[model samples]
Target: MDLTHSAQDEAFRREVRDWLETHLSGDFAGVRGLGGSGREHEAYDERLAWDRHLAAHGWTCIGWPEEYGGRGLNAARQVIFHEEYARADGPGRVNHLGEELLGPTLIAFGTPEQRDRFLPGIRTVEELWCQGYSEPDAGSDLAAVKTRARLEPVSEPGGPRQWVVHGQKVWTSLAHLADWCFAVVRTDPASTRHAGLSYLLIPMHQEGVEVRPIQQLTGTSEFNEVFFDGARTDASMVVGAPGDGWKVAMGTLGYERGVSTIGQQIRFARELDAVVALARHNGTIDDPAVQDRVTRARMGLEVLRLNALRMLTGPASATPGHEVAIGKLLWSTWHRSLGELAMEVAGAASLTAHAPPYELDDFQRLFLFSRADTLYGGSNEIQRNIIAERVLGLPREPKP
Candidate 1:
C-alpha cells in the first residue's frame, strides 16, 4: 500500500544491504527456491545455517508475530524486506511448507499446544513439513482424494485420539527429509466430495509409511511418492476438525497460491539479472530486438512482484478468482519467455563449457522447469474458468 518507503524502512533496507554485501558474492545465485534441487549436502547445510542466522536476526518469518520468533513487521515492511533482500541478492530457501502453510494454519486454526509445539521448531528448521495433498488420482480435482483415515479412540488414560490412515500420496516434496506431512484423507465417503474429509499430520519415518523418491527430469530427487499402508497418528495431529479437511486444505492452498509463491517474484528478478548479464556479455544487448526483449523481461519481473504482493494483501475469499488467474498466466508466460530469451542471447556459446556464469545451463534448467509453472498451482485453464464464471460472470460449461 505504501508505494514509497519511510526513513525507517530505508534505514532497515540499508542495514540488510550492508549485511548481504559482506555475506553474499557476485555469483551468489542458488536454487532460487526449494524444488527438486540436487543433493548438495554443503548447500543444504549452509542454507540451514543461514536460516538460523536470519531467524536469530529477526529476519526470518517476516509476517509472524514477535512471539513466534519474528520481527512482527507489517506487510509493507515485509515487502521492503523482500525487496531489499532481492536487491542485495540474498533470499533464502528455508522451509516454505512450515513458514507459509503450517505456521499460518497453526496461527489461525491450531490449538495453543500445537502452536507452542510446532512454531518454534519451524523457526529453527528442526521440524520440516511437506504437503500430502495430491494423491494418485487427485491433482486439480483435490476433493477427489482417496487417502483414508479412520479415527480410533485411545484407550490409555490421557492418551490422544488415534487415526489409522492408508493411501498413496504423490508429488510430496521433501517427504524424505520431512518429519511430518499435513495431508487430506477421506474420513467418510458417503458424505460427499467436499465433506467427510479430514486433515492429519502423518509421521514420515514411521513403519507403515514408505517413501520413494520421484526422479525428476532434472535428474534431482526432490519429490516423492509416499505410501501409507496403515499410518497411525494421534488425534492431536488433526489440523482443524473432523470432516473439516477440505476447509483446512483450502487454507493451505490459499497459502500456496497467495503467499507460498511470493518468494518467486524477487527470485525471478534475480534470474532476470542473470539473463540480462548473459545477453550483454555475449554482445546481444546491442541488438535492438534483444534489448527490447530484455527490457520487457525486466518489466514483467517488476509486474510479478507487484501482482504477488497484491494477491498476498487480498483476502482469502478473493482466492484464485479471475484476476488472480490473469496474474498467474502472465507470470507463467513471462517466465518461459525469459528463459527462451536467455537461450537466444547465449546462442551457440551456451553450448560451450566455458560460457559465462550467467550463460550456463541455468536457463536450460529454468526452461525445463518453466514448462510446468502454468500447469502447477492449478492449471492455467482452471484459472481461466474461474475468471470466466466468477470474475466475468460468464455462463458455466455444460455438465458432461
Candidate 2:
C-alpha cells in the first residue's frame, strides 16, 4: 500500500525496465505490444517464444516462492515488475492462466508431487493451461455446473485408478492451445450446487477431449467449447479431496483477481492514451461532451488504480473477499466504457475495416473486444451480488 518506493524497489524497477529494453529488440522486437484478451491469436508463436525467454531470464512468476522456480518477490516488487513490463509495452503473456491462477492454487493446496510435476512446466512455459469452469448452462453461475466425473474402479492393487469425465465447458479461453485444463466437475451425482465438485487437472491431448474454438466479434477464436466425453485423468490429478473442489475453485478465482491485474490496468491506461490521441488528431477534443467523457475516464482510471492497491493491501484469503468483486466491477465497467469512448472518438470511421483482408484496426478491435470485459471473469451482475451478499452482509439471493 505504500505509494513511495524504497531504494531497493527503485533498483528493481530499473532492472525490469533495463532488461525489457535490452531484450525486447532484435528477434523479439516484433512481439512488443502483440497479443492480449481478444487478440490471443496475434503473433501466437512469437509471443510464446517471448514468454519462454522471460522464463529463461528468471522473470516469470516472480511472486511465487524461490523454491518453486520463482523470484519470491514481495507484493511491492511484483507491482514494480508489472508496471515496468507494461511501460515497456511488453507483449501479453501466454501463460497467465498457469502462472497467475493455477500455479498459485497449486502452491496453496496441491501435494508436493503435484507442485513438482506442474510448476516447472508452467514456469518454463512447457505446458499451457485453460480454466474449465464455465459451461453452456453455467457461465456466470459456476455452481450450476453439470460436468460430471467418476472414478474408474481399480482393477487390482496399485493398478492405475483414474477419473472418467463427461461434459462440456464453454468460454474456455485458450483451450485450443492448452496442454491441460483444470476443470470443476460433479464428482458425486447426488450432490448439488457447490457440493460434490472436484477440481481435476485433465489432459487435453488424449481421446475423448475436444476443443472447438468459438469465433468472437473480433473474428478471433481465443475462447472455445471444450467437450469432455469420457476424458480420463489420474485419480491423483484432483486438487483437493473429492467433493471439496468448490473451495479450491474459489481459491483459483481469488487468484484470478490477484496482483497480475496491475498489468491489465496499465494496458488500459495505454489504450486511454491512444483514445485521447485519436480525439486530438480528429479534432473531437474540442467538443464539450467528448472532453467531459475523456476527463471522467482519466479520473476513473486513477480511482481504479487506487482501488486495486487498496484491494491488494487488504486481508489476503484463500477465497476472494468483497474487494475482488468490487475490483472486477470497477475495472470491467471502466474498460467497457473506455471501449465506448474509443468508438465515440472514431465516429464514422469506426464502421469500416482497414483494407483487402478487411482487418479491424486497433480502435475497432479494442471497441469490439472490450464489449466482453464486463461479461467474462464473472459478470457485472455477479460482482454486484458478491458485494451485496458478502460485503454488505445482505440476504443471499434465492436459489432457482
Candidate 3:
C-alpha cells in the first residue's frame, strides 16, 4: 500500500486539523483529552455537547454515503480525519457506538423504513446506541446468547406486533446513557447455537429495562450490566429477517473492527509518546533496557498502522475475515504491554491515588485498565481461534 499522501489528501488533512484547532477552543477548550476507555466518566455532558457540535457541522459520519446525511469521505480521507482528530487531542466521541457500529450495519442490512427512522438520529448524534451481543454465558462465544424475544400482538386489533424481550447483558458499554440497543436474541426457542437468532432494536426508556453501572479498577463506571424483563420493541425493529440475526450481528462486529481502528492507533501513539516523555522526566531514558523497550514499542506501533492500512485497502465485506482478528490480537497485546511500561516508568508514583475518591492520574488509569485489553471486545484466545479456523482453514474445534 502507498504510504505517501497525495496533494489532495494533504489538503484534506490540513482542513481537518485547522477546523479542530479552531473549534476545540474557548468553551470547548476544557474538553481536550477528556473521555476515553476507562475514563468515559470524565466531563461526559460537555463531551456529548462537543459530539453534537461535530454533528451540526456534518463531521460525525464522514464515511457514510452522502444520501445518508454524511460527507461520504473515502477511506484515505476518513483516516486523515481520524488521525488529525487524535493529534489535536480532541475529546473522546460519545456517539461512536451509534455512528460507527450500528449505523453501518443498518445501512448495509436494515429495511428502508428502518434506515429512515435511525440513520438521521445517528448522523446527528441525537440518539446514542449500545451493543447487546454478550450475555452472562456468551462473552466471546456470541452465539451462546440466551436473551429471548418473541413476537406478541398488541391489544388493538390493527396495532403492530411487538417483541417482548427478557435476559441480562453484561459489559454493555454506555447502556445507561444509550437511547437504544441492537441486540441478538433467540427468536426461535427450539433452535440452538448460531441458528434461530434475530437482531432486534430495542428502546431503552421503559419500565422493564434496568442499567447498573459496573465500576472498574479505575474507579469509573463506563461498562454496565443491563437487565431486560419483558422489554419490548415493534416487531419491525428487527434489522434482518428472523433467524438472520447471526448474519447481521456478525456484520456489526466486522464494522466494530473496521476503518475506525486507524483512529485508535493514532490515540495509542499519543499515549506512547506520553510514556516516553515520562521516562525522560524520571531519568529512566538513560537505562539501557528502558531505551531498548521504548524503541521496540515505537516499532510495534508502526507495524500496527501498516497492517490496519493494508486491511482498509482490501475489498469491503460485511463479514470480517482473519485480518480483523489479527489486528485485535496485535493491538490489545501491545497496549497491555504499554500499560506495564507506564508503571515501570512511573516507579513508586504510580502506586498512589491522586485524591480521596479513588482518583487516578492518567498513567495510573492506563496501567490499571489496559490489563483488561486482551479480555474485553474479544479475548486473545478467541481471536487466535478465529485466525486459525477462519483464515487458515484449520479444522474447527469440537464442541461439547
lDDT of each: 0.74, 0.92, 0.91
Q: TM-scores of the models, in the given order?
A: 0.85, 0.97, 0.97
Positional deviation of residue 382's Cα in model 2 after best superposition, in angstroms: 0.7
Q: Estimate, for each residue in 1-400, the C-alpha lDDT of model 3 and write its tens digit.
A: 8888999999999999999999999999999999989988889999999999999988999989888888888788989998999889998999999999999999999999999999999988889999898888999999899999999887875778899999999999999999999999999999999999999999999989999999888888899999999999998999999999999988888788888889899889989999999999989999998999999999999999999998788754434556788998999999999999999999998888988778888889888999989988888999998999989999998877
Residue 211 displacement (Å), model 3 = 0.7
Candidate 1 lDDT tens digits, 1-400: 4367789988887887787666564333452242223332226656766666666766667778778776677666666766666656454555778887888777777888888988998887788898898877887678889989886767775656689999999888778878989899998867768899988888788889999998764456677899999889987888888898888877666656554454467677767888888877778899999989888888888787778777656653343334667677778888878778877888885555444443325667666567767776667777787778978899996767
TM-score winner between candidates 1 and 3: 3
The list of candidate 1 runs beyond 4 A from truth reads 22-42, 154-160, 259-263, 283-292, 312-326, 348-360
Model 2 per-residue lDDT tens digits across residues 261-321: 8888999999999999999999999999999999999999999989888777754433456
> How many clashes show up in model 2?
0
Give the Å error, residue 359, model 3.
1.2
